[model samples]
Target: MTLAVLSGVGVLAFAGFVYSGVYDVGADNAHTRPVLSLLQTMRERSIASRAEKLTLPPLHDPARIRQGAGNYNAMCTGCHLAPGVAETELSKGLYPTPPNLTREQVDPREAFWAIKHGIKASGMPAWGKSMKDDYIWNMVAFLQQLPSLDAAKYHEMVEKSGGHSHGGGESGAGHHHGGEPMEHDDADHADEAQEHSEHTEPASPSTVPEHGKPGHHH
Candidate 1:
C-alpha cells in the first residue's frame, strides 16, 4: 500500500511539473528560488560534462588577451561588468542581472564555451554563428586570466586592443525601441552605478540575462 501511494505521488508531481504554466518565460520575471537553483545546477553540470572532453589549444599570447579584452569591453563589459568596472542603468534593471566575471566561481573552459555557444533561455546568444572561430578562442584565452586581473589591467588591455567604448546606447546591439538605439537620459557611468543595488539575486560569479543578447556585440 505504501509503495503504491509513493508511486502515485511521483506520477502526480511529474504531471504537475509538465502541466503547470507557472514557469515564467519572460525576461521581466525574476526566477523563484527553486527554479533559479535548478537552472544554476543545470548550467554548472552541463558545462562540466561537456567541457571535459574538449581540448583547448595553448593560448598564452598577450595579443590574444588584448583582442579578447576589446571584444569584452565593447560587447560584454556593460552587462558583465569587468573587474572594478561599474554597471549601467540598462544593465541594472535586467532580471538575473549580468554576472561579475572577476569573481571566483567562473571557470576557463566554461567561459570559453559560454562565449562561443551562448546560454539558452537566458540572454546569452551563440557567438559561433556570428563571429569567427579565432575571435571566440581569443576571448576564451582572455577569460582564463580574468580572475587575476585588476580593474586597471582590464581597462588597459581593452584600450590597447582597440576597444574604445563610448557611453550611451551606441556600444550595444539590441534595442527595445525598434532597431534604433534606446536613449537613456542619465548618461554617466555614475548613473550606471545606481542599478547595482537593485539586483534581486546575490549574483553568482558570472551571469548574463537569458535574453539580453549575450556574446554578439553590434
Candidate 2:
C-alpha cells in the first residue's frame, strides 16, 4: 500500500513538471548538477556499451597517423581544436563544447565510434555517410598520438606528413566545400604541402578551455 502511494505521488510530480513549463532548454545555461550528471552517465555508458564489440586496429601505424592528421586538420580543427590551436570559431559557441582532443585522450574504440557516428544533439556530425572507414580509423590513429605532442611536435609531424592533407588545395578527392573538385596529382599535393608548411609558424601550446575562452586564429 505504501509503495503504491509513493508511485502515485511520483506520477503526479512528473505531471506537474511537464505542465509547469519551468525547464529551461537554452544552450547558454547548463543543466542542473543532477540532470547533467545523469545525462553524462547515460552518454558514457551508451558509448561504452555500443563500442565494446568492435575490434580496434593498430593505431600507431605511421601511415595511418599521417592520413588521420590530414583529415583532422581539414575537417575537425574547427571544433575538436587541434594541438596548439585555441578554441576555434565553432568551438566557442557549441553547447557542451567539444572536448579538447589533445589532452583528454579517449579509448580507441570509443573514438572510432564517435567519429563514425557523432554524439546526438552535439555539433559533431556522423562522417560515416561521407567518409570511408579507413579515413575514420586514420583520424583515430592521429588522435592516439595527440596527447603526447606539443605544438611544435604536432606541427612538425603534420608538415612532414608528405602531402597527405586534403585541405588547402592539397587533394581533390575528399570533402571539399564550395570549390570545384579538380583532380590533382602527387606533384600538386607535394607542392601545396611544402608551401603550406614553409610559411606556417607552429603556435604555442594552447590553454585548455577551462572557462569558455573565446578566440580563433586558425
Best by lDDT: 2
Clashing pairs in 2: none
lDDT string, candidate 2, 46-164, tens digits: 99999999988888889889767656655666677766677754678888889989888788899889888989987788877667777788889999898898877776666555433
Report the alpha-carbon TM-score of model 1 versus the true structure: 0.63
Estimated TM-score for each candidate = 0.63, 0.69
The global C-alpha lDDT for each of the candidates, from Candidate 1 onward, is: 0.61, 0.68
Poorest 10 consecutive residues of model 1 by lDDT?
171-180
Off by over 4 Å in 1: 1-29, 164-218
Off by over 4 Å in 2: 1-9, 160-218
